[model samples]
Every structure is written in C-alpha cells, then in structure tokens.
Target: MLHNFTYVLFKLKLIQPSQKAIRFWMDCEDTDKLEFALKHGNYKTRKLAAEALEQIAKPCSIPALLNCINDKVQNVSVACLNALERISPNDELIKTIVRKRFNWVNEIREKRAKYEANKHVKHTIYRWRRTSKESYDRVKEQLKKPIR
Candidate 1:
C-alpha cells in the first residue's frame, strides 16, 4: 500500500537526516510525524518541527505543545510557547492551561499546588507570583508617570 511505502520512506529519511525529512517534519500535512519529531528528535530537528507544527494551525496539537513547555532547553520551551500562542485554541482545556499559567494573582500558588500534587518532579517554581506582582507594579508605575 502507498501508506506503508510512505511510512517506510519517512522512517528511512528520519534515520538518514535528509533535507526532505526536515521538510516533511516541517511542512508535511502529517501532525503525527511532527509530534514525534518534536518530542524525540534532536534540537535542530525539534525546533523546525515546532515551527512547522505551529504553521499547521491545528487545535489537537496543543496538548503536546503544552508538554514541551516543560522542556529543559530555553529555545525549545519558547518555540513551543510561541507555537501554542499561534495555534490559539478556544477549547476549555487549552484555556484552562493558559489561564492557570498567566493568572498573576494565583499563578505561583496554583503552580505550587499542582507541582506538589504531583510527587514526580523534584523542583517547584517558587516566588513567581511575588516577583510577578512586583514587576507588574513597577510597570504600572512607569505607565502612570507623565513623560517630561
């Protein structure tokens, strides 16, 4: 079958590191391969894979992108964040995740509760809401100041 042939060719290209594979990872209509590359491939491959996935404009991929937010690499995290921003899902699930992240007043408390709720991760994000509130106040003061 043609699908099997395409699958074989995809696997071969991924193993061989061809430009075609990168392109397929980037621009192909297959979200499955893009998700796989984003999670398991090397940095360059994952970066391009994230970019391509962002361009696909599909809501179904946001959960995978959300998982990428916890990646250790800063660029990878940023790419995933920006991509999720681009996808802009109106679903309650995505909305809840984003709101939980950006909700300044309770962001840290909520994150702490969530992290503590999970005993797997060792480190927790601390002082985020405090620092965020301080930064917000400073920015607000600056905005209120009259330009000379």
Candidate 2:
C-alpha cells in the first residue's frame, strides 16, 4: 500500500499545500496511484491534482476511469466522469460520446441548456411582472419531468 509515500506526503512542510503537492501526485505516474490519490486524497489535494494533471491532459488517467464507467453505483461513474472530464475533455471517451451523440449525455446537456435559457427568460419576465411563488414552483416542477 505505498504507506511511506502517503504518510510522508502529508507531514512534509517542504512541499507547499498546492502546486508542489500536485506535482508529487503527478510524478506518481501510475494510474492506480493517481486514482487512489483522487479518491482518497484530501479535497484540496484532489482538486489541485485533477486541475494540474488536466491542463497537461494526460491520457493515462482517462482510460483508468473508463473501466469504472460501468460501475454499478451511479455516483462512481459520475465521479469518474468528473475526474476524466477535468483531466481531458477532448479525450476519446468524451469525444466518442459526443460523436455518437449518446442519449444520456445529449439529453443532460440539452436539458441543462433549456433550463438555463428558461431561467434567464423567466428572470426578465419576473422583473416586469412579479412572479407568484405558486407560478414559479409550477414552472420549475414542470421542467423537472423527463422529456418524452
């Protein structure tokens, strides 16, 4: 279990809490190590590591997470996607989904776009005519329904 690296890592004042720590994680190079760091590493550690590794858009970590896509737990895939998306948005996995127009990704993006556009329109309308709580709730509830 690489306990030496893990334990010594936290205690080292030599490495600042930000970029230095991230570089250490990146140097680990092993996708398994990176994945372990991502899952078990502290939030600031994970977030910085993901961001740093992302700018480089290393391909190693992306494939590691791809295998996790089919994980039974929904959040596992979501987290995998989140990490992979950060690491490399243009990576094949994302591009494949974009190219294929996978229903899941397409629907989610479309729904989010629609909701944002609707919210802007509603906000403008509300400025002119004060929206009732009931009316706003009805609109929001209606938007929540799955598209046929």
Candidate 3:
C-alpha cells in the first residue's frame, strides 16, 4: 500500500519528513502524518511539521503542538510555540507557557545583572533569555487580536 511505502521511505530518509507532512496536510483530513513527523523525525522535520500545523491552524493539532514546546531542540521548541500562537491564541496552555517563559527571561536577566555566574551557565542563560523574550513578544502579538 502507499502508506507502507511512504513510511518505509520516511524511515530510510529517502524522503524528507517535512515534505511528507506537507503532502499529508494536503491529502488527509487528520494530522496523523504530521504528528508522526513531529514524534519520530529529526529536528528539521519537527520544525517543518510545526510550521505546517501553524499554516493549517487545525484545532486537532493543538495538543501535539503543545507537547512540542518541550522539545529538546531550540528551533523545534520555538517553531511549536509559534505554531501554538497561530493555532489557538487564547488557549490557557499557550498563555501559561508564554507567561512562564517571559517571567523566566526576566529572572535570568536580573540574575545575570546582579551576580557573577559560571561562564557556561551565563552563555546558556543568555540564549534562553533572548529566545524567551522573542517568544513572549510573538505570543503577545497573537493575543492582541480579538478572539474569533
């Protein structure tokens, strides 16, 4: 069957997972393929899946996107956060994640300014702080729109 063939190709990396996800987005009503890409594919695949989900803005993808916010890769996490903003701006989970990240950024900034931290920790925190601020801004912009 075509499904088995596609899965084999995906597993072999013969076809990019993102491309597969896009194909599924166009051909399927459900997000089974996209969710598979997010869960099993590489970081680039996960990022692309998030982007596709954002474009689709399907409510069904919200839960999967929410889980992606915790992805170990920064790019994947950011993509998921942005997708969540597009899909459900008013969701309490989105609000909580954005607010938490924003507050964490503030705390990092204050700590970095007030105390002398290890060089590695400082570098890591700096990156996280910057990303958190950007994510907060994006979520805030999304929230500004009147709920439909």
Number of the predicted model whose lDDT against the real structure is largest = 3
Better of 2 and 3 by TM-score: 3
Residue 118 of model 3, lDDT score: 55
Encode model 1's per-residue lDDT on 43-134: one tens digit a residue.
77677778778888787888788887767665676678668877986567666665654454256568878878886867766754688889
lDDT of each: 0.70, 0.56, 0.75
Model 1 is weakest, by summed lDDT over 10 consecutive residues, at 13-22
Separate clash counts for every candidate: 0, 0, 0
**Clash tally for model 1:** 0
Give candidate 3 regions above 4 Å deviation. Answer: 1-4, 11-30, 102-148
Rank ordering of all candidates by lDDT, starting from the highest:
3, 1, 2
How far residue 43's Cα lies from its native spot in candidate 1, in Å, is 1.4
Best by TM-score: 3
TM per candidate comes to: 0.51, 0.38, 0.58
Model 1, runs deviating above 4 Å: 1-19, 89-148
- lDDT for 9 in candidate 1 is 62
Q: Residues 16-73, candidate 2, lDDT per residue (tens digit)?
A: 2455545665666544545555545555555554454455456777665565555444
Question: Candidate 3, TM-score vs. the true structure?
Answer: 0.58
Instruction: Compute the lDDT of residue 32 as modeled in candidate 3.
Output: 71
